[model samples]
Structures are given as structure tokens and as C-alpha cells.
Target chain A: MATNITYHPSPVTPTVRSSLRRQQGLTIWLTGLSASGKSTIAVALEQALLRKPYNLSAYRLDGDNIRFGLNKDLGFSPKDREENIRRIAEVAKLFADSCTIAITSFISPYRADRDLARQLHHAERPGGEPGVPFVEIWIDVPVEVAEKRDPKGLYKKAREGKIPEFTGISAPYEEPLKPEIHIRSDQTSVEDSVKIIVGYLEEKGYLSAPPEVNEV
Target chain B: MATNITYHPSPVTPTVRSSLRRQQGLTIWLTGLSASGKSTIAVALEQALLRKPYNLSAYRLDGDNIRFGLNKDLGFSPKDREENIRRIAEVAKLFADSCTIAITSFISPYRADRDLARQLHHAERPGGEPGVPFVEIWIDVPVEVAEKRDPKGLYKKAREGKIPEFTGISAPYEEPLKPEIHIRSDQTSVEDSVKIIVGYLEEKGYLSAPPEVNEV
Candidate 1:
């Protein structure tokens, strides 16, 4: 009995909040290898979503951007990485709860970690009735391709044994078995990748609303 | 250098996100004792804010609600409490970055932790330019009054030695040195408290647009 802590939020449900904000909340979780163009595609997708006439606001949570703030205390250790992923998942849930489309770009290398993130979104609420819609997109690219496109030169460093525990180098980068959307960043243009993902969102009925209108 | 890592996001800044979202981001942190009506006042404030004409969408982050999801891994220990507050603060920053007015209710009994949160907000972005506005609201309620008005019977449990490390009971509560808005929750009605907070927000130039309009 003592262990049962109930959460009583205001009568405002996600549906109500969604109506008020004129947008449906969804989490676009992008996972892939380092330098595989996750952040780039995410940015393109965010810009594309912003250009839409619908009443939607997509918020981006770049892995690099978050490392400087939310995951600031965390390191590159396995345990720290798990905690970092967990915290990001929680933050994404909170953002979705506010009826804002959450776009998260991270190199969540471990399958277990990414699965945990999905599970968190699946049953985020107190009683776990209405789960948040999570779209896990895999930016698939070969290590060689990623290394060639390494703007940060991280691939060369990881190969030179400079950065330990680097994904696709020292640490293992577990690939997603069946992602919602799979695309090779090397082959596909950022615009095409964003288009594909936005098409998925639209097909899933997330864009089922009028343009820039409010309901009382 | 091999040790260097670069993060490339869109040129859009928080100001752009705020403008595009058509709302200014604000963080109203409500701190007080257990059963001191922080969550109640926060809910009322949320309702009041919802009635505003601006494009603002205020999201409530209740302690009880978050513990079931984001802070579920944490406990009531000192270290865990510190980490809990830190994580919540980070999430609030993310919410604010999305141009949502974030209302958080927590009994964050440590001044250092709260100060760290404030600093995190003031220096949130990578460039450290124009941080989000954070308003610390102290729901000042006497310990006797709080214990008398124990809605969840937490005070009784703490007094009976059933719940250790309770703020204002066994654990110490370090009050804010100078909070932006301070109100006695024990003496004030929830509606009145919400009105005072809304007035503070208006006075602080957070209410920059028209009153309530729900979009469909």
C-alpha cells in the first residue's frame, strides 16, 4: 500500500492537450552509427516539418546538443551511456506529453538501450493507457561510408585508437532488427530521407488536421 | 584534434523556435514543503495560463507524476534526490527550448541543486547566448501548517518514522535565498495563488500575446 504512489494530473488528457496545441505528439527516434548522418537528417526533417502548413511544431533533441546539457554529467562509459539514453527517452516522453513533436537523434548503439527507449514511450503515462507514438528510424550506412563522410574526423580518431569505446570501432554498435524506417544516409539525400519519414508520419495519420487552425 | 567532436544543427536558435512556435518559453519552478499545495497551485496556474490569449502552451511537471516515469529509477536518498532534481531541471530546459511554458512542482529541499538548475537554464545553449527565463516561485508554508494539512498523509508517515529522509521532517529544507515570486500557500487559496503567479508572468513580459484560443 505504501509503495503504491498514484499520479493525479489535471483533467487535461493528451487528446485535450493535442487539440489545444493543434498538433499530435510523436517521438521520432533516430538511431545509427556515428557520422552516419543521423543529426543531419534530423535537422532536415525538422525544417521540413516546420515548413508544413499544419498546426505542428517539431522539437529536435540532438545527441550532441543533449550531451552538453541533460547528459552533461554522463560519460562515454557503458553504464553512463545507458543512463544517458534512458534520460533522453524520459525527456522525449515529457516533450510528447506537451503535444510537441519530439525529434531525437542519437547513436544509441545498443539494441537493449534502444528497445528500452521504445518501451518507455509505449507505456509512459501513469496508468499506461494511451502510449505515445514512437517512430524509430535507422540511418543505415556502412562503416566505410560513415568514415569517409566523417566531418568531425571521429572515424579516423576512433580507428587510430584515440577515442576509446567509440561506436563501430571499440564499442559495439548493435543495429536495429526492424526499424520503422530504414535508409542509407550515404545513398539517400537528406531531403529524400526527410521526405520518406514525413510520408510515414502522414501515412500514419499524424497529419490528420487542418492548417494552422485553433478549436475552442 | 581527434578529441574534438562537432555538433551541426540547424541555424535556428531558441528565439526562432519560440517565434515559430508563437510563444515565449518560461520555467516557473514551484518549491515548497510536502502537502504545502504546490501541485494544487501549479494546476490552477496551468488552467489560468490555458485561458490566456497567447499561443503559449503551459505544461505541468508534477513531482508525483514525474516520479512514476522519468525519476522512477531514483529514490529518496540525498544523492538520488539531487540527481532527481537535476534530471527534472534538464527536462524543463528541453520543454522550454520547445517554446512551452514549463510549470514544475517539487520540494527541492537543496539550495545548491536549485541553484545548479538555475545556472543550467541561464547557460543552456551551446553558444551560451540568451538563456531561457527561469522564475523560481517559493510556495512558502510553515512546517506546522503543512503537517496539519497533510493531504497524502505523508507528514503523518514521516512523523511516525515510517518514511525517513522526509523534507521538513527528518530531512532539512534549505529555503531559497531570494526567489522571484514568494507566496504563502497555507494562507492563500489555490486560485489566488495561481492569480498571483499569472500576474507575475504578465508583469515579467511573458504574456506577450492575446488571450485563450484553442486551435483545431
Candidate 2:
């Protein structure tokens, strides 16, 4: 009986590489409305982390790159939304395990789904593999402000019925009850936002003093 | 009918936080078998990238985290395998959108499943986000060697029927038809494997030249 099955080996031993990087690995999940400055703040935060001795990899899953590929077949349904966030959370965990800064931004409006992500992050690795830490950051942008500043005219389209199940307008955006950090984009400038983020990271020990960069 | 939805303003201005971070964004995908050294390599790669001037994030999804969560109900059935990879790929795209290195590890044996990941990487935002580069690297180790080094003892249990579906041994292991790189643990050493991978990154322009670091 020729069963159509295939197998592959698993990998172990990232400890040495992680030590070389000199930073603990974790996932920074940014959740908020479309124009709540989630992506903007995430981007700024990445730059702030760069000047330090840490290695940070930031991934933002906005409308631009996701609509076509992994989610091409997914429509704007509540179920799809959960699935979408669920998938992203899983990937974020993977990044965390590799000892890199895995950052993600999504509406992720449901408490259960966001909690689900947290749960996955804390899980132990199979066969004694270490677990990756999951950090949930809520980019707290008021719905009204987000609608007013729809960067891509998404709010307008949602109201006009051009896009069904739009988040914040047609759809729902659940405010995170509790998060590692809450960034109110409306109140702060992008630079200040970066400063605040960097400040937190510094306190968290993710940052080190400015290095003498003359040596390459 | 108040349907608990979050709304935001439209026509938001593009901020520097978003623009600046875009320049430093990239994806680092780590693909390999179970215990063949994919996660180990991914962690090392993340550490290496962290020392550079770019913002890099690493994501590693293997047996422990994923199997216990979103994929908890699912088994190692073929359909489940496809679904598992599909979900992870979708999440990776989201991370990529955020402009971070999204490194994932799985025994994505079949080419079809791997191709699905590539397709997911190519999915774009509404206007079509630039295709997220899909780098597939096969971390190669002979099945027997992998079983011998079964860090999780999965292969052992699988052969004994304790596990219904497993990769290698009782299951099939389809060699990647077109892997971007092949890291053979059997013949090559770990340092050599890392060298090969880092070399690929340098070749791809992901890694910059070394810099001298002076600690205070």
C-alpha cells in the first residue's frame, strides 16, 4: 500500500544563536483601529529599537500586503476575522521563539481571540523546547478619531457600502481590556510615540547604552 | 441597533513613524523538519540580524506552541497539514505587512503545502502589496539520522504506532523540489549551516558588512 505521505526532520539548538544576539526574543502585538496609528507607531518603534544592540524584526499585516496572498480567499466575516488574527498570532509566536523581536499590528477586535494569542505564546515547546513570550499592546485610538483619519479612505468606503464588514465603522473593534502598553495616537505625535515605546523597551532591558559604533 | 463596532476617522495623514520603519522591514522565514535544526538556525539568524542596523523580528512555530493551540483540535492528517501550513503562511504575510522578519519552522514536506506558503506570501493588499519574498530553505538531514536525533522522540513513538501520523520513518518525506537553500545536518556542521544561511542573506543583501562593537 503506497500511502502518499511525507516527512521532514525538526530543528533544535537556537540557544547559541540567541546568545549571540544579546536580547531576549518576544512578540509585540499591536491591536487597534485601522488609522489608530498602529502601523505608524509600530514602524517608529522599530526604528527606535534599531539604534540599540538588539535585533528587532517588525512585521505589520495591513491591507496592502495581506489582502492578496494568505488571506486572498478570506472574506470579511466575523469567523474570518478570528481566523485571520489566530493565524497571525501563531506566526508571531514562531518569531518569538527565534529570539527576534516579532511585532504585529491588527485590528484584532475580539478579546477571546487576543487572549487566544496570549495563551498560545505561553505554551511550552514540545520535547522541552522553550516557549516564546507574547506581548499584547493595545494601540488605543478612539473610534471617532480613527474614522476621521482613515488614511486610505477606508471609513468612507465602509459608510458608502463599497466595503462590507469594514472594521471600526461597519465592523467592530474591541478595545483591549488590558495590554502591555496602550498608545493613544491622537494625543501623541509619532516621534513622541516612538520615544514612549523606546522608553518602555529601555526599561524592559531591550535596549543598551549607545554603542561606540566606530568598529565594524 | 447598536452593533458594538469601533469606528475611526478617514483620510489620516501618513506619518514618519510609518515611512521610516518601512525602509528597515524584511522577512526571515526558517523552514526545516522536526529536530533537524530549523528553529536553532532561525534563532541564530535572528541574533545575527539583530546586531545589524535593521529592524528584524523572528517567529518560530513548531510542535509545542501551534499543536496546543489554534491547531489543537487538528491532527496530522493531510488536510490538517495543509490547513496548518496555510494558516501559518497567512499569519506570516500579516507579519510581513508590518515590515518585520517573520521566521517560521515546520516540516512543510509536500511541495504543494510549501507552494501554498509561497502563494500566501504573494497575496497583496487591495491594490496588491508588493509580493513578500518567499524564501524556502530545506534543512536537510537523513530520516534515519533525524530519528536517531529525535529530540522530541516523535519518530520513535510514530514507529511504534503511539502516534498515528508522523513525518519520516513511517510517513513520507518529500524533498523540496526547489528549496532556496539546503542545509544538510548529516554532512555539514552547525557552524557551516549558519555560514551557508548567513551567506545567503548577505548574497540577498539582507545582511550588511560586519561592524566593530565597543561595549562600555
Candidate 3:
């Protein structure tokens, strides 16, 4: 048994944590309309990253977890919606700071909201530590396609005027002008979608352990 | 090189996640007055868990992260304090649900707030999945000792009437009636405090990988 536990007196910055864990932290922010397969692709992507070759610590933040837990007090009002995205972004940054890959899937209709999320990830820390990587993935699908494939009937409710202020129906979705990766869910299989996202992560060196920390 | 990524269609419950990660998720909630050595002990315990013999994934949530990031909008008002604790508890639960050891160090004086944090961790999921484990550790220290050792001079400010509604001065601290682990920080060394907490976790089998998930 190793009895000597080293004391780390300095604050744990992202750099120190990356070196300690032998991995860099990043967030895969998936934005799309309802039924655009954001959650499906997120699930597959999380599984891919957690399994054999990657063996990374990855977790997902989607409606299932966020809507019922952290943001349950929030509603569809514009202010509430912004607060919802804000809290999610903060939590995702926290996960990334902990050296875990955070995957967030949400409609996140407003460009300002998504930009705020991106800015939160890119902001410098108090000790001058670099910000975590934020990868915006646009899961694109026509509103018609999304409504046709409404698995939970959310789009149907939106179209029927039962759910007010719904995106892609009564409201707007400001598309990402420069997303890191864009996938047309209508034209891509779930497996291929995961491949595209994972490939982008690998090519950008986000999937592997950081080179400087590898020797540790 | 491993291209075959398993598809996990079902919703990922705590059981499924524990099985996949070969570890159970848990939260070690540490409550004490400011300068009671809560943060010091938390940092050491986190290092101990992440290093050689334990090799577990652990993360700390404290004022440095929460106060400035997630709960930045909050102030020192009574309502803001309660909201602060609520958000921290929710985020800690999310980390635990992701199979990470969440260590929260806060001067959470109100027993109701701490109880709400415990309740969030103990409530059953929507699908009947068992709640994640919550360990309430009380770092006990005399108010006079804490005041004397105030590293940030917060106690001095409170006593001088510069900081109103300060805990253990203008406000109150409701001690835990039945904390899982209690340490008198005034008497114990930082290393021994960690040992005592970790020993409790080990004895309760919280440190070991779940038997059912060990072979995965």
C-alpha cells in the first residue's frame, strides 16, 4: 500500500490537472432542433469515447438530466431559457475542468446562448491558466424532417400550438455560423455521425492524451 | 485501433454507469466554518484518491470554483446563500452520477441546506434506480480557534462589523446531528484528517470497485 500521499499545495489549475490525469479536457457541444438526432449521436459518441481504445472519462448533459435536475425550476420564458443554457454551460465547464470529456446536447436555439457557452469555456482562469477546449457540433436537420421524426411528440405539440415559444415552430433557431463540426442528421447514420465527430476530435488532438503529459 | 463501439440504447442509469466504469459514484460532503481546514483536507484527500494505491477519479468543489464560476451571480444574502448551496449540491450529484468521487468543501452552516443536499443524492431516479451514496463529513473546530487562524482575515472583518451576517458570528451554524465522519480539525493533522476520512470510506467499501463490475 502506498502510504505517502503527496500534498499539492498550489491550486489545481487546468494544466496541473491535465498533467496529473495524463489527459486534456474538452466539451463537445451538440446543438440542433428537436428530433434532429442530437441526443442519439451524443449517446453513441459518449459510448465510443468511454470504451476500449479511447478509455476516456466522458459524460453527457442532455434534457433527461438537466431538465429534471438542475434546470427544473426554469421554464420556456426567454429569461429562463437563457438561465438554463447558462447553468448547463457552467456545469459543463466544471466537468471539463475535472479532466472529463463533457458532451452537451440541447437545442440551444439562440446564437448568443451558444456563444456564451463557448466564451465560458474559452475564458482565462484567475491564475492565467488556459481555458478548456470547446467544440461546437451542429446537428442539422430541416424543421420538416425533425417534425416528421418527433419521437417524443414534442414537435407535434409545438406545431399544434400546445407548447408555446417552441424553437423551429413558434420561435427561431439561430444557426451556428462557424461550428467546429456540422452534421446533417437527416443524411447521416448514427454510427457515421459519431465517426465524424470523433474523427474531428482525433484530428484536432482532443481525443488522445496530451503529448507533454503522456510521459507521466 | 478498436473500431467496434458498443451501442448502449437504454438510458444510462447509475447501475449501468457503475458497471461500465467499474466504480460506484459517491459524494463526500464536508461542512465546517471558514478556516476549519475543510479545503486543506479536501485537497489532500483528492490527491490521495487519485494517486498510486487508490487510483480513483476524484474532483473537488469549493469556493474557488463554485463561488466564482457557477454561482457567481449570487451574493451574501440569505437567499443567495441558500441558492448557492442548492446549485453546489446539484452539481455534486451530477458528478457523482458520472462515477466520480465528488468532494465538496463549504461553510454550509444551515442544516436545512445540508439536508436538502443529502436528499437530492438519496432520492430515487425516475426509473427506480437507486440513489448515489452521500457521505456527510463534519469538520468540527471551535469558533475561537477558527477565528484565531483566519487565513483570509474573514473572522476579523466579521468581528469588526465590516462583514455583516457572517457565519459563526452574526449568523449561526447548525451542527450535524449524525454526520458519517466527524473530525476535530483543531486537534488532527491535515494528513491524519485525510486518513480518517479515507479510512471511513474504505471501511464502508466506498473506495473499492463494486464486485459485480470488477471483471468488466
The prediction achieving the highest DockQ against the true structure is: 1
Better of 1 and 3 by DockQ: 1
How high is each candidate's interface RMSD, in Å?
3.9, 8.6, 12.6
Residue A136's lDDT in candidate 1? 93
Tens digit per residue, CA lDDT, model 2, B1-216: 112223322121112222433332344555566778776776566555544554344444445455555465466788878877787776666555544556677777778878878876765533323566677888888777888888767777788888766777666668887788887877877677777877886688644322333321
TM-score of each: 0.92, 0.63, 0.93
Top candidate on TM-score is 3
User: Which regions of candidate 1 deviate over 4 angstroms?
Assistant: A1-5, A124-128, A210-216, B1-4, B209-216
Superior by lDDT: candidate 1 or candidate 3: 3
DockQ numbers for every candidate? 0.39, 0.17, 0.23
TM-score of chain A of 3: 0.92
Native RMSD of candidate 1 (Å): 3.9
True contacts kept of 2: 0.18
Expressed as tens digits, the lDDT of each residue in A13-105 for candidate 2 is: 344335544445677888888788877776666655543344343334444434444455556688877777776676667656555566776
CAPRI grade of model 1: acceptable
Highest lDDT: which candidate? 3
Write model 1 residue lDDT over B22-94, tens digit each, in one string. 6778788999888788888888777667654554688998766578777888788889889889988888887
lDDT of 1 by residue, A1-216 (tens): 124255666756666566666777889999999888888888878867765465467889875658776678778889988988998888888887777788999899999988998998888464444888889999999998888988888888888988889998789999899999999888899989988998999999986652442443
In candidate 2, stretches whose alpha carbon ends up further than 4 angstroms from where it belongs are A1-18, A51-57, A61-67, A122-136, A160-167, A170-172, A209-216, B1-61, B64-66, B69-73, B87-107, B115-216
